[model samples]
Structures are given as C-alpha cells and as structure tokens.
Target: MIYTLERTQFFTCGLDEAWAFFTNPNNLATITPDTLNFKVLDTFDTPEIYEGMIINYHVTPLLGIRLSWQTRITEVVPRASFIDNQEKGPYTLWQHTHEFFAEDGGVRVKDTVRYAMPFGVLGTLVHKLIVKNKLREIFDYRQQTLEKILNYPAHD
Candidate 1:
C-alpha cells in the first residue's frame, strides 16, 4: 500500500526567492539532517530548474547503509511548484511534489510525498516498525533547519 506525508512551512521570503532557494540542488544538503548524509551528485549547468532534470544522490538513511537514489524532475512551474519522481531508490515508489504560494507574511512552502515500500507484507511491517517514524523525523529536522536558515518563525 502507498503511504503519504505532507508538510507545510511558511518562510519570510517572497515567492521568487523561495523558488530560487528551493530549486537549487546545492542547498539540499544544508537543510537535510546530518544523520542522513545526503549528497547531490549533479552539476547544475543552469540556475533555473527545468523538467527532465536528473539528480543523483548517495544517502545513508538507515543503519549506516548507504544507497544510491536517482530522481527526475518531472514537472516545473516557475515560482510555483515542481514534482520529482524517484527513478531508483529504496522505496518501491516515491513521488514528491513541492509547491510555493504567496501568503500573508511570506511564502507558503508545501511538500507532499507519496511512497510505498518493497517486500509487500514485510514492507508494511517495516513501515510500521521504522520507515514511518523515520520519515517524520527527517521532515521535522528539515523544518527546523529551514527555519533557522531562512530566519522564519518556528511552527508548533
């Protein structure tokens, strides 16, 4: 079964600034948790994001076991939103959508991730035992890091 996770954050920045910051692949490591050891393996030739862009990364998400993850930028809307689908990764399915909106005080950033595990019933068991909480922890760290870097107020 596929599982979903959604996170929303408000940044004290404009849509364009938020878009540029989020679209830059280099900034990923800055926001990601240190424990994950996430690294992007792409030399961005252009500053603007375009569809079909492929990003490769090495991440140690669990038990110090490093894995290669490849994702393709499937859709892009400047200053609005983008979607990335996993090409190869630990999960059986991974699709992440990032959206930006102009809110009262700043830009509202939203992320929606849909993923499924491998190994059928075993995957379900693992999800319950570990993956679910791990995902939450990852996003929680992201939110905290983003707030610090962006100088935005923290959420409860």
Candidate 2:
C-alpha cells in the first residue's frame, strides 16, 4: 500500500523564519496534533539537520498503543528543502519532503509524503480504514497550529 499526501501552507513570515521553525525539531511537539501524543524521546544534533541524523520519538496515534518512531534525515538543502525517511517506524516506507519558498508577504511551505505500510494486502486495508484519515487530520492540525505560532510574537 503506497500512499502519498501533499499539502501547502502560506505563512506571513520570512523564509529564514519559516525554515528555522520547521528545521528545529524541538518545535515539532508543538505543531503535531495532540491526538498523536507525540514526544521526542532523544534529540538529534541541533541548528541544522544533516543527512544520517536519527530522531527518536514515541507516539500513540491509536488508542493505548504506544508506537516507537524513528526517522533519519536522508537529504538536506539548507533553507530550500529536506527529506526524512523512516528508519524504524509504523510504515514500511515513509519519506517526507519539506520545501520552502519565499512568497510575496511570507513563505510558501509544502509537505509531500510518500509512504507504504506493512502487512502487504492488509496494509491497504488499514490505510483505507484509518491511516489515511489520521494523516489528513494531523496535517490539518499542523497548519492551524503553525498559523498561530507564526502570526503571533512570543509575548503574544
């Protein structure tokens, strides 16, 4: 079961600020949907994410089932884009590409994910029944959360 999802968001902030927000793993726990119960267990090297860096996390996307998630930064292009691939996680293959562009008043951000799950035929069933919607919801929450964070200053 191969699944791909792409989403774009416009933010009223500069490219550098946008890139800084996304590239910083610490902020991930904030934007991620609360339903996922996402938490970063071990931190990766800070400032810039380079290839071969591992991020360890624990999430409970489903009820009471804690999942150990791990992903590696497979590619990086400074403030332009980066790709992270799942090394050990829920998916059989999960690759997410984050691209940032300077728009008129801010930055245009795009997230593209290409993934597949385990269990072959059964994975397709799971995707249709649960994973697909879960992914959509997560990204939707992300957009809203980011908008609030980027629009308001720290003191706000």
Candidate 3:
C-alpha cells in the first residue's frame, strides 16, 4: 500500500539559513539516525542543490545489512522548495518534497513524502509491521535533531 508522511517544524532562523542548511546534502547524515548507518556514496562538487542533481547513498535500514539508494532532484526553486524522487531504492516508489517559507520571527519548514513498498502484498505487510514504525522513528529523530540544531522555540 502507498503511504504518506508529512512533518513541519518552525525554526528560529532566517529563511536563507534554513534553505542553505537543508539543501546541503552533507547535512542529511547529521540529521539521520545513527542506527541507519546512512552514508553518502557520491561526492557533491558544490553545496548548491539543482534540478537533475543525483545523490547516491547506502543505509542499513534493517537487519544491519546495507543497501544502496539513489535519488534525483526533480525540481528546485531557490529558497522555496525542492522535490526528489527515488531513482533506485528499496521502495517501489518514493517522492519527497521539501518546502520553506518565511514566517513570523523565523522560517517554517515542511516535508511531504509519498512512497510505496515493493513485493506487493508482502510489502504491505512488512510496511505495517516494520516500515511504518521505522519511518516514524527516522523522522522523529530528524525533528528532534533539527529542533536542537535550528533552535526552534519550545512549543506548548
């Protein structure tokens, strides 16, 4: 079954700072959970993210076994938003969009990810038993780490 996950966080930083930091591919590993063993397999010549940019990486998302994943930047809008789709990955489909907006006293950041697992029915079962929770764990870690890094004020 296809699934979607959306997360938003308000950062007490300027839009430019948020955009620059998020667009830098290297920062991904920093925000990702250590258990995943996420590592970029390709080097980026420049920090700037642009359309058609491809990123390759490997991660041990389960069973401590690593698998390579590749994603391409499908669209980019300067300091506003960008979308990336899986070129080769574990999922049958994956598309993630990152958006940034200038907001009162800071920047609001959002991520929308739509993805589907492989193996048809088995994939759906696995997603129900594992993938669903793993994705939440990963994103939860990211949100906490970003909050610390970006200094978002505490919410009531």
Candidate 4:
C-alpha cells in the first residue's frame, strides 16, 4: 500500500529566497533532525538545482543502522516547484513534490510525499505502527528548524 504525507509551512521570505534556501543541498542538514545523521555525499557540478540531478545521502532513520539513499530530481520549476524521486532507498517507492507560493509578503511552502514500503502486508502494519508517526515527527522537526533558521515566528 502507498502512503501519503503532506505538510505546509509559511516563511517570512519571498519565493526567490525560500526557493534558494530550500534548493541548496547544503541547507538540508540544517533543516533535518540531527538524530537522522543525514549527510549529503555528492559534489554537485553546479550549486543551483536542476532537473536530472542525483543526490546521494547517508541517513540513520532508525535503530542506529545507517542507510544510503539516492534521489533524482525529476522536475524543477524555479521559484515554483520541484519533484524528487527515490532512485535507491529503504522505500520501494518514494516521490516527494515541493511547491512554493507567494502569501502575505512571504512564501507558503507545501510538501507532498508518496511512498510505499518494501514488504506487502507487513509494510502496511509498520506504517501504522511506526512509519506514519516517524514521518510526522521528522517534518515537525524540519518545520521548527526552518522557522528558527529563517527567523520566522513559529506556528502552532
């Protein structure tokens, strides 16, 4: 079964600034939870994100067992949206779309992730028991971290 998660965050910055901050690979670690030990391993040919870019990372999501993940940038619309698909990762299928819109002198960022686990029924069980909540927590951490880094007031 495929599971979907969506989150939206409003930043006190314009679309261009928010787009630049989010697309820069170096800023990922700052937004991600430190417990994940997320590290990007690739040296990009260009600092600017573009279609067909492949990003590699090592992350420890659970049980202190590190995993290597590779994702390809499938779509890019500057200051608008981007989509990333998992090329190699724990999930059998992982596709995440990030969108930006101008809102109240800032930008409203929306993230939608669609993913499926490897196992069949067991994966569904895991999703209910653990994966779902874990994903929410991760995104929650990201929202707080981003707000702090961007100097935006936190929301409830």
Q: Local distance difference test, per candidate?
A: 0.91, 0.89, 0.94, 0.89
Cα error, candidate 4, residue 21 (Å)? 0.5
- Which candidate wins on lDDT? 3
In order of listing, the candidates' clash counts read 0, 0, 0, 0
Please say which candidate is ahead in lDDT: 2 or 3: 3
Looking at model 2, which ten-residue stretch has the lowest summed lDDT? 147-156
lDDT of 2 by residue, 1-156 (tens): 678999999888899999998888888899998777899997555766788888899999987799999999988898899999999999999999999998887889999999998998888898999999999999999999999977645343
Clashing residue pairs in candidate 3 (N, C-alpha, C atoms within 3 angstroms): none
lDDT value for model 4:
0.89
Higher-scoring candidate on TM-score, 2 or 3: 3
CA deviation > 4 Å runs, candidate 2: 152-156
- The order by descending TM-score is 3, 1, 4, 2
Q: Which stretches of candidate 1 lie over 4 Å from their true place?
A: 152-156
Query: Considering summed lDDT, which 10 consecutive residues are worst modelled in model 3?
Result: 147-156
Q: Candidate 1: how large is its RMSD?
A: 2.7
TM-score of each predicted structure versus truth: 0.94, 0.93, 0.96, 0.94
Clashing pairs in 4: none
